[model samples]
Target: MQPYCKLKSSTRSLSKLVACSALLLLLDLSRCFSHHTYEWQDSHTNERLVCKQCPPGTFVSQHCTRDSPTICKQCPKLHYTEYWNYLESCLYCNVFCNFLEEEAQPCNSTQNRACQCKPGYHAELDFCIEHSSCPPGSGVAQLGNPQQDTKCSQCPQGTFSSVSSMDPCRNHQNCSAQHLEVNVPGNRFHDTFCTACKISKGSEASDGLEDGSGSEDCQDAVIDFVPYEIRVPRRLRRLKRIVSRSSQSSKRDRKSLEELQMELHTYLVQLKNTEKKELLLMFITAGIVSQSEVAPFQISAGKESLQVRRK
Candidate 1:
């Protein structure tokens, strides 16, 4: 019983020794973990640190001692710091939008610039709108929406538009019957009338004007007026007055010559007619004389015939 008690005591002591050694090893590991540190630098490179690195998305603007971590500041207003142990200063924010006044927000070291539309100008699409009305004689055909202006056009000459718009033309010619031959088709300002062309004696026209005054070419009418030459009888030609260039012949001499020729021609025609009349008279006289002579012979023949018949 005494030997069994000594073996149990030795075994118990060995277990206690093993437990104490494990406890010492754990304490040593804790001290090593506590002593673990990282060197850090400030943005100006003027300060130093003896601790772990700063967190991501944050930058150390100033160094810290063993008792304190580095002073980490957020990036300037709208900007952000995305680096670790940043040796440079924090960046500023960029403009959120642009402006036409040239007073837009400026971009920063860490952000890009932006743009936007102005007031009274809707940016529904990519265009601007002016809800202004059309001028006096003009009107709008298509009324623009919030993004576009209302388009207006002019009222044409013949058209009388009460309102200005982009509408099509309307007012037309007011031609009526009674003087209405054919409506010369056009706008209201042009020739729309109740007039007609002239109709003259021995001439005609499609418009209301005299011959040679109308559309007919005067040159063309002259061409039709006179022929190149004319012809007359030889007897009439002899009666025409002739100008004499001879020294002995006066102007009156040529006139006398023409008169003489006309008289000669007239006498020749009269003589020919007289001869024809005398021959007709001679034939008649011969016919009467022959008839008388023949009648006496017939009577004597008849008497002879009667005596023979009596015998």
Candidate 2:
């Protein structure tokens, strides 16, 4: 009985050891199954656990992990990443700008380099634009360079420019004259230059018409005789009477004053009568001469004739 009891005890111990060993084996299997496995895949495989994250500026379509079939995708061309740990995909870069000197800052979800425009280029919705030119005569030409201009110009001759940002002037077509009677050139308009007429050629009362040559008429010299003619009459006859009196007054001064006085009075009376007749004769002669000169053909004709009648 003792020996049988010993064998039974040994068998029970062995069975317990076997059961523990089986339990240990099952735990080991469970641990082996629970631990993560690394899976390196070609470009198209997908994985679940321990999947890699996509890189910056890149998007991942699938999750990839260890030891399973994984889809490991590279970033598109022109793309880069800062890190590589668990990176599911690489990012795509921005399009290249030929005219820009430097990269621009990133925008939106895309991780790209910013593009900077060169000098003299303005930024417009992802593009660089050139500046516009100002119009002539607007006074824009006087401005500094690199200015964005819409118009430019200069002032006319008659008019002056006040603003710097002005367009050039249109040709002045409406020039004006300074005075009347001056032949101002026609077709002067729109701020054309103004000119005065020649001093001698223009007058306040003269007509505005221009002759073949521009000149003025000179004034003629004048003489006056009618004012002096009527004041002194019979001057030559009076002088002739004085001369005759002087000639007749000979050497009888002291002897016979009464006789001398009588003779002088008589001579003076005769001189006055003679002077009156001479004045009548002067009027008659003037009348005759005037008539003859005015009517030379009206003189009556006469013929000298002698006739003897026989008895």
What C-alpha root-mean-square deviation, in Å, does candidate 1 show against the real structure? Answer: 41.5
RMSD after CA superposition, every candidate: 41.5, 45.0
Give the lowest summed-lDDT range of ten residues in model 2: 218-227
The reply for model 2, stretches above 4 Å from the true place, is: 1-78, 81-87, 92-94, 100-102, 106-110, 123-129, 137-311
Candidate 1 TM-score versus the reference: 0.18
Give the range where candidate 1 is weakest over 10 consecutive residues by summed lDDT. 302-311
Candidate 1 residue-wise lDDT, 262-303, digit = tens? 333343334433343332222124332122221111112112
Model 2 residue-pair collision total? 49
Over all chains combined, what TM-score does candidate 2 have?
0.22
Instruction: Give per-residue lDDT, candidate 1, residue 238.
Output: 30
Per lDDT, the best of the predicted structures is 1
